[model samples]
Target: MRQLVTVSCVLLLAVSGFAQEDSSQPRPFVEIAEQDVKPSVQAIAPIDDTNVFFLNKRGQAGVAKFSPGLSLIGWELYSKVKLNSLNSLGMGPNYSLVTASPIEITQAFDTAGDGSLDFFQGLVRDWQGRDNGVRITAGPVADSNGRLLFALSPFSIEEGQPPLARLVAWHPDSEGLQTVTESQLLISSFSVGPDSLLAARLSMPAYTEGYYISLTGLPSFLADSPDAVPDPLPKTLPSLLIPAELTGGKEPTQMCFFGENNQTKLVLTCPESNQLIEIVPEKSGSQWQGAILLRSQTPSSIESVVEMNSGLLLGGGPDGFFPLEIPAEAFRIESVNIAKDGIVLNFSEEVDRFQGVKPDSYTVKAVSLRGDNKTLMVEPVIESDGKTVILKTSEIGKGVVLRVVCQNLPSADGDALFNKTVFYTIHES
Candidate 1:
């Protein structure tokens, strides 16, 4: 066996507590630190410190071995084996998840204390529908002793009916593939942990009902091989988006992001078209809760804000995000379709509020003074909270150009006090 260890270090200099303060900036921002990443070979099915299988997107199946440093040592390819399945290989405590796909296809990787790769490619004859090809996607979960467990799933679609999905396990020793009992679930994305397996699934019609799952099982199949490891605890992850609550106007009305803690995060929508509620912890013990709004700034076509879990918010200007604060009062308008609606001087906060300008106000106005200026009128729909405004147009012309502006934005504080402007066009087509 080969062993390799790598470490990294960073240094910074700080002044004494009596250091003079810089009036240029009042608030201090914490630096986000990240650990250095390790380097290694990328494999289709990587197991333990010794075994790593490679895959060919061109449809070939094979396994490759390398030294701890990642130098290729040897390889075995089964070009004759047709790839009806695809997935990233992973390992677990007793058993590992092998060949996971959108389908419920799976195999439990277990061997009788022997260090050898031997097992049947978990397959279900009727797994895929008649019209679809038979493909099983498998990936690694974990490795214990000389064995590994793999998550499996099948993918197929049919008309007049929701697709079917199943989960199975595969062993690498004497016994080949053995079917494991699984819930009838529609899995979309998943990941495996040291003691639990996390998965995301959507109900029929895709958006109706969604959920997350955390599962653990025994090493040896009690129904088949009782001498194996005992089953572990099961935990379920929560869905990123909760349709019932969002549609009903809950605190976190819309789900904007959902994902595993520390490892990764996922954003569900655009911020400009949607609101970015703060990220919260989930009860599933493996994910975070997020909320979003569904308002667009452009001509309903140009997306303004992008919601994401990590990195930074995209396209919110150099400071990120247009203002959301608006007047709360309401007003009425005659029609919906029209051209240049005239210059509406919208602000980030209510026009009559006494608290002074808030840190999150923004605004946008018309593109030109001519065209349809005389034919359109601008009025506040929610004047109190400054959320939205109404523009009545006499007719639908070529296209309408609207400009957006912002003020008192927290991120843009020291740079500029004046609100900025952006343009959006309205079209009949």
Candidate 2:
């Protein structure tokens, strides 16, 4: 298999030279199963290469100790609420030490297969009420060393109330949720990277446009400082930022981080085409200096960044009541497009593996039209270059509608996320 690049593709612009055209070529796409990946999780938290954890919608969480080969050493129910949304989930230092509201906000674990979750814990939650148009949030931050920090927002339920959002360092070796206080501009979307934390705050309000990205509390910046300040130490990374805009004056959807650190990318999708966008870190720094790599109007969106490790992520648009199943920042789909031949599809790190497949992954299928009065149906063969799946059609004919789907294939660990499906039409050139 060829080692592909680390960039994620967006379908906004006309992607040329993607499908190497050949009349009688060796089938470019093939249909095959994937290998078994343990710690079957829809929500993944990566810690180095040895430790990681996964959480499911039912609130079930498990830990994996991997030395390339993972062993499910521990499992538990870390939350009390039903984890219905895939994007409204996250992980921190450890499961037991953090306290997230609604009982099921989010938790974290190690991926390097280490027994210790770096001796830290993470908690996250959003607030909602009938009268109060507010959303409260919180989480924890842990470094390679034994230092731990707590992130909290003191109830944003009412207008005119001071936003008490800040990051505080809590010494587990000491006691209580007290210690150094670190505050910064309120953030709407953020995620911890391999060596730093990536965050974004709306420049104005949700009903408006524009936002800023920044990184806080990285060791590289704190190396020279003798005393750690009581505020978010910003990391200056310019190429890893995004500014969301709603065209035609449409309300912007919320965003959330699908997974903490690296190992997982973000995703967002809608029923309609061209409704989402994905983001990634282009570089590392101390302030908002990154660029939004890919932008589009496709209904499906994926982060242009890929974690060359183990993990998964999922997110989508509002279903009516809530602002989509997941938060806007988590895994928002940046865009979607009908193939030149009119084939619709979905792809992300959230899909699972197959029992009989070489690599644990998902599959896409084509559907029929006229309810049942069908004439011809085509299928897709799935192939990969170690990164994304490449699908080859059986053959195309006139007046045919193909439905492509990414079904959840079972893995050694278990089922991960729901399979996605898209439809396409074929016409004569």
Off by over 4 Å in 2: 1-42, 47-52, 62-99, 102-136, 147-150, 154-162, 176-185, 194-205, 217-241, 245-286, 295-429
Q: Mind giving the per-residue lDDT tens digits that candidate 2 earns over 1-429?
A: 011111112121125443222223222211122324322343344444444444444434434343343323334333334433332233432233332332223333332223333222122222223124322243333444444433444333246755444433333232222323223344333445545453433223543333344444354424334234434434222222232332223322233344434322333321233344343333223232211222234333322111214433222222110111233323222222344442323333322223223222334333232333332232332334211333434343434334443344432334332223333333222
- Cα error, candidate 1, residue 290 (Å): 8.2
Strongest candidate by TM-score:
2
TM-score per candidate, in order? 0.32, 0.37
Query: How far does residue 10 in candidate 2 sit from its true spot (Å)?
Result: 46
Candidate 2 Cα lDDT to native? 0.33
Ten contiguous residues minimizing lDDT sum, candidate 2: 1-10
What is the lDDT, from 0 to 100, of the residue 135 in candidate 1? 34
Candidate 1 contains a number of clashing pairs equal to: 84
